[model samples]
Each structure stands twice: as C-alpha cells, then as structure tokens.
Target: MIDPVIERPRLTRYARGGGCACKIPPGELEQLVAQVSNRVGPAVDPVAPLLVGLDGGGDDAAVVELDEQRALVTTADFFSPVVDDPYDWGRIAAANALSDVYAMGGRPLTAVNLLGWPRESLPMELAAEVLAGGASVAHSAGCHVAGGHSVDDAEPKYGMSVVGLVDPHRMLRADAAKPGLPLTLTKPLGIGVLNTMHKATGVVFAEAVDTMATLNRDASAAAVATGVRAATDVTGFGLLGHLHKLARASEVTAVIDRSAVPFLDDARAAAEDGHVSGGSRRNLEWVTPHVDFGGTGELDRLLLADAQTSGGLLVVGELPGYPIIGETTGFSGHSIIIR
Candidate 1:
C-alpha cells in the first residue's frame, strides 16, 4: 500500500524551473540587493559588538558578536519542484536550507518555513505535506520549525529560515583555505543537468530521486568531523563559480584533477543531448573567464559547473591521499585550473 501520509505530485507536466532554476538570476539579483531602498542603521561595534557575522566567510548569515562566547547563525533557502513527489520536495528543500548552518559548524535550534503555493490550483493539503516534510528534516537536525509565512503564487515553492548556535571560534567560513590544502567534494555532480533532462523526458531514476532528496547532512557532518575550514554548497553558481568565490576570498588558486571529480550516471548522455538548463549554461559562461580546463571533455566541464538547487557541499581542506586531486596555491593567475 502506498504511504497515505505523502501524496504523489502530478508529474505529467514537468516544470521549466526545477531546483535552483527557480532562483532569481544573478544580474537581476545583484540589482535587487543594490536597490534595498531603506538606509540601514549603523553596524554594531567592530572591536567588540559580538563580531560574529563580520568575518563573512560564506556563513549562513552574518553572525553579530553577541559576546565573547556564543554567536547566532541564520540561513534561508527555498526552491520549486525538483521531484514529482511532494514529500521528497519538502525534504530536499529542508536539507538545502539547513546546510548553511552546518557549513558554518553550527547546530540548528529552530527554523521557520518560507512557503509559496498556488492553493487554489492544487490541493490545499499538498502544502501541508510540504510543511510536514520540512518538519521531518528539522526534527532530524535536532531543531523545530516553529512558524513561517506563506503567499499565494502560481508556482509551488518551499524551504526554511534556520537559526543555529555556534562557538565563535568554530564558525567555519569559506575564506580560510590556504595554499596546498586539498579540495574535495562530498557529493557527486550533475544534479542540475540530470534534473533538467528529467523534466525534458520524464526520465528520473529511482536512484536519482534517492540521491537528490538525500540530505547534505552526511557531507556537512564530514566537514565538521574533518575540521575542514572552508566550504560552500554547490548551488546555482555551479562548482567553478563557488570555487571562484572561495579562491577570491582566500586569495588562493584551486587546481582540480578533473578526472578525480565525481559525476552522476544520468548526466553523461543528457548534457550531450543539450537537455541542459539555462542556469547551467549561464553558470558555465559566468565562470569561464576564471576557469581553465585542460582538455577535459566539454560534457565533463558542463557537469562540473552545472547549477544545482539543493546541491552538495564542496570542501577545501587538508589533503586526504585517497581523494587528492589538486590543491590551493598562491594565485596562479587563474581562479581554477582542471588538469
């Protein structure tokens, strides 16, 4: 018998936007940030006022220095349908949102739902399933989804606003990668490309759903466990762009062994067939100037930089023999080089 608790979403019509495709594009997004019409109040004291958020090392949020010991971490992420199953969507969305907290080496204490749905078009209760899914993930993270806001919209969207606690010293940022540190990716690539193809042909693998819907929990756990200092999720920017941010912030260059990187099975043929999304291609374009591929197949390059919704975490850390590909080094005039 089917689990009555989770209703199956109608998959007959695939969304043009799945995962991070639903995200606002970069150029427009920068404009939005710049046009924040209100004049912000003066910042807290730099010397002391709880310097939690000031370091800006790709943390979930700028943590204000509350005191000498504790700091607050905040992160938010939400996206449209990446899977046909409503519950899976919720779980993946929650995972994506919570990852930021973990990336910063923080533990979530609470969360708020950020929701958008076309209630009149779809079953009102489907929205509830999404909420339940988010609740399930929040519980696993040892937190609660206390409350949230919703709005009526044409598309269905879900995610979270998470608040986590961190020791001021343990707050991991994306800026600490030093020369010679190895770069490792915790999860496989091609989620964005594969999902785009899934929409184009309805060719989702049972395994792919299992993969994408799976949490970044383990990946985040590994980062904290390994004490990997600089990290970020492989979201809409694609690997190279996010890596560029890391390299830029850390003042280091990244050298990746293209063959050493991971890829998903569904990715190979789909990217070649051009079932790619605008975001992935755009991501390719954005990072091309900063990236250099050493005869790696075009398909491989696309997979590496594909934009993802609730994607995996890419980590830069001290070298591990089994997975060592390349390392961070003093600026080599390139942000990233794949051998």
Candidate 2:
C-alpha cells in the first residue's frame, strides 16, 4: 500500500506532459524523419545486416541479424511521470520500455536505466524509490539491469534502453501485416484519459496503474506461439495512430469494429468528464486524413485515438484469449476504416 504521508510531493506536478502523452506529435515526427532520411540516405553496415529499421516505417525496435537463427532487438523509451507515486511511475516506465522487445517477439536479455532528475527540487529519496521500482519489475521479467546513466534535469524522467534476442523465423514485424487477418488487442484502452484525470484531480485509478505496470510478456509469448507475425504495441500514438502506421507499412486497410473494442470500466466516464489529453487530440487529428470514421461519434473517435502509455500489443492475427476488435483488408484508399 502507498503511504499517503510519504507521497507529499505529487510527481505529476513536475511533468508538463504525462507518460507517452509527452511524446512529440506523430505527424511532425514523421515529417522530420522523412526529411532526414532523404538527406542522409540509408544507413548501411556491412558487418551485421539490419533486419528492421526506420526504412520500414519505424518498427517497435531496430533488429539486426546476429546469425542465421538469432537476431538482436534494441529499443529505448522514456517519458515523464504519468502518476503521482514515483514507484508506480518507475514500474510503468520500465514496463513500457521492455514492451518494445516483447512486441518484436523477443525476450529481453538486459536493460540500463535512463533517469533525469531535478536534483535541486525533488528529493533524491524519491528517485531511489523510482529506480527500485524499475529494478524490481526488470528482475521479474528475467532481464538484467546494469548500472545506468543519470543527468540533473529540470523535469524528472525515467525509462530504459533494452537489448533482447529473438528467433528470426518467428519474429513479429509491423510491415508483415496482411489482409484477411484478424486484429487482436491484448489490453483495454482509456489509460490516457484516466491518467489525464488522475493528474488533474489527484484521484488514483488503481485499475489503470495495474494495466500500465503489467508487462506484455505473456501476450507476446502467446503471439509467437500462435504463429503470429505482425504486431506493434500501442503507446503514445494511440490505437488508431499505431494501426495507421501498421496498415500503411503493410499496404493494407484496418477495419475496426467500434462495438468490439474493449475499454476500462470508467474510461468512458473519464472521457465524458473532459479528461482527454492534448496528445490524444493531436493523435486523432494526425490520423484523420488516413482514417474513415463511419458514423462513429466524436467521443468514440476520441477514445479510439486516446494515447496510451504502457499499453498492449495490437497483433495482426488472432489469439484465443484476446478479443478480435478488427480485421485487415485490402487497401481501399484509406488506411483505416472505423465502423
């Protein structure tokens, strides 16, 4: 149980943008990348062939072939606090960082902490709690956490850079999605709005915290075992935004059944209370051109595009226990169609 007395300084107060919502706008990021890629050209390394990189519409991680059967998956993710409790923030950030490896059908081998603390303002004890939380979660995932780098900064930040290994044959790729495959989401949506509410009203949502802190390892293992090949975890971009990236990369159209999508019990209520984040609004606007919302109400659309923090894997193929919220179809001008 969290001690109310010890939680004196609300961590969320220091964060300008909370969790994945702190990420740069997807549209602006893509444009910048496109320009840089055009000027720099493809980065070629003769030593180890890059199996997956930015050229393929930016996957969950950068994978490089290490040998005939194995490949190396590397990714880094960090964000500002999404919750008031430093320990929970650390766990959520660690889970979010490790998720990239799992999303690629890889098992994390090692990780290094990435921390930015306001040494002058926040107490160092809080940072220790945050690191301890991250370490505990990493240990549970069977990933080694070596010493990491820290910097004195204005706003406190935390996450990790993870290295993992995957079987090349069974690896999941965002660009591998194909038409006719069912889209399966392993977790529910609405984390963004709930977090937004929490940051504003100081009401802790236990369900949302658990959802964010839970690792995606089980879902990823299930996907690999089930012969699934295309998947990506939902994060700052939200479901619709991430789905748009997957569809565009695979040259397919994703058809989402709004009724079938799952949500937290109070997600709709939170959204109705105007707890939506600016990043979520930006997500909807960015994907507006590529998505065809068929009679879906504004509230539902906003919920669909609500930016997630440590969200779930949006797999292109079905899993037994998860819900099939949509299916991929041949491209019909638009990349995504919500009905």
Candidate 3:
C-alpha cells in the first residue's frame, strides 16, 4: 500500500508537452518512418496475408490474424498530463490509448500500465491516484489491468499498452473509405486549444475534461454495427491531418463543411485568444498545401487542425449521435477541400 502522508505536487508542472500534442510532427514522422519501414522490408507471414501494414494502409492498431474468424490487435500510447487533476489526467490517457484498439473494431482483453515518475520529487501516493484512475477506466471496458513496468524519469507520464480481440471480417480500416460516403466525427474538436489554455493559466474546463476522459467503446461498437469499414481516431494529427490521411489511403478526396463542424464550448474562444499550441499550428502547416481553404480563415483552420487527445473516431459512414461533417469525393489534386 502507498503511504498517505506524502505531499501531492502539481502534476502538469513536470510535463514537457501536454497530452497528444507532444507527438512527433506528422511530416517528419512520415519521412523517418519511411526509412525505417524500408530498411526492415516487408514482413513475411506464412499463416495469413497481412490485412494492414505500416505502408500507410493500417488504421489505429496493428492486427495479426490468429484464425479465420479471430485476430489480435495491439497498440500502445502514453503522454504527459493534459490536465491538473491527477485522476482525470490518468483517465484521459488510458482512454486515449485504448481508442486505437476500438478504432480497429476490437474489444480490449488486457492492458499493462506504462508509467514514468519523478520518484524523488513527487510522492508515490499521487502515482497511486493516477494508477487507480487508469484501472477504473480499464475495468469499465471489461479489460484486465495488471502490474506493469515503471521507470525513474524527470517528468511524470502515464498510459497503457493494450491487447484486444477482433473479427478479421469486421475490422475497421483506414484504407477502406469509398467515394460518396459521408464522414462523421464522434466527438467535438478544439481539445488542443482548451488544453493549451489549461496549461498556461491553470484554469479548468470541466467539459473538456469530461470529453477527454470518456472512452470510445460505444462509438467503435456503433461503427462496426453499422457496417462501416473505414475509420480513424482524431488525436495528435488533428481532424484535417487525419482526414488527409484517410483520403490519401482510400484514394479519395474529402470535402468538409467548416460551418457544420462542432466544437467544445469556448473552444473557438480559446483559439481566438491565441491559446493554440505549437503542435496544432504545425498540423495546419502540414496540411495547408493539400487543403483548399476556400473562405476559411486562420481561426477556423486552427480549430479544424487542432491537435486532440482522446478526441474522437472519424468514420466513413454516419452513425447515431454523431454529426456528418463531410463526404468523400473522387480523387482530386487537393486531398481536403474546406469550405
């Protein structure tokens, strides 16, 4: 048991970059991954042909078919605090990590905690709170969270590595979108801006906190139930970045209606107040060349390209409770058309 006498420090203070915005830039990551993937060459599978490989075809999680009917899905994700509350931060991180599995139409089976702590500076009790938070969410998903490895680090980081089960025939994929299919986003955008504001001023927004901590299980189940095959979770890459990837992989173009997109309360206000993060701005820059920003301005672009943490699943077909923001079109020179 952890001692209760230890002092609780402000967790966000130790974070270098908050939330999913800490990820490597999309453009640079693609270039570096290309070199590594080329060096490793194609993987040879004697049992079953690879359904999704790293060549920009796979969606969130990697899947290996175990049999004609079953497949194993694996993914890992972690980040520093996006909010000040230790428990809430833990919940948000766990949900974000598990989202990859769900996006692939898999149900979590087991998870292992991934933690980095400044043991000398922060008390172990606080870490326990974080752990408890993660375990609570994992339990809700009917997943087992067992003991995991922890490292001594300068900052506090938390998340999980998850394994899930899926049907090989019903799995959702990033490369399966078709022309004329409607696009729907399960959650609102602007998380990155809200998080930036929180990091800067220590002000709390309950709505953003609740949104981030919520799991994507229902959304995933809905996507699979509705016979949707193409989907990707909107996280560090932002909506536009992920949309660009979806369109490119599916060999189609995306047309998003800027007016129809939804945002968390005060999200637009945060961006208008210049609370945007560098990661979010980078997302806009990466997709600028490929997007047609017809009448959209800087604020709208920033909101659309805002880097998000545990954001939402962007599905090709419509599902109940989600807004239809765009539709797929035949391949065009521009990958994204924002009007």
Residue-pair clashes per candidate, as listed? 6, 0, 0
How well is each residue in 195-301 modelled by candidate 1, as lDDT tens digits? 77776665656666666666666666666677777777778877786788778778889999887877778677778889778887777777788887878777777
- Expressed as tens digits, the lDDT of each residue in 1-339 for candidate 3 is 122344445577788788999999899988888888878877575575666667673468888889899999999999998987788988998899899999999999999999999999888887888999999999999999987889998888999999999998999999989999999999999899999998877778999999998999999999999999999999998999999998988889999998889899999888989999899999999999999999998888989999999999999999988999989999988989987
Model 2 lDDT at residue 156: 94
**TM-scores, all models, native as reference:** 0.88, 0.97, 0.95
User: Across residues 1-339, which tens digit of lDDT does each residue of candidate 2 receive?
Assistant: 233676478899898999999999998998888999989876666689899989756999999999999999999999999999889999999999999999999999999999999999899999999999999999999999997899999999999999999999999999999899999999999999999999988899999999999999999999999999999999999999999999999999999999999999899999999999999999999999999999999999999999999999999998989999999999999999998
- Number of clashes in model 1? 6
Q: Candidate 1 at 143: error in angstroms?
A: 1.5
Question: Which segments of candidate 1 are over 4 A away from where they belong?
Answer: 1-15, 31-59, 318-325
State model 2's lDDT: 0.95
Evaluate model 1: give its lDDT.
0.73
lDDT of 2 at 310: 98
Report the backbone clash tally of model 3: 0
Say which candidate scores most in lDDT.
2
Index of the highest-TM-score prediction = 2
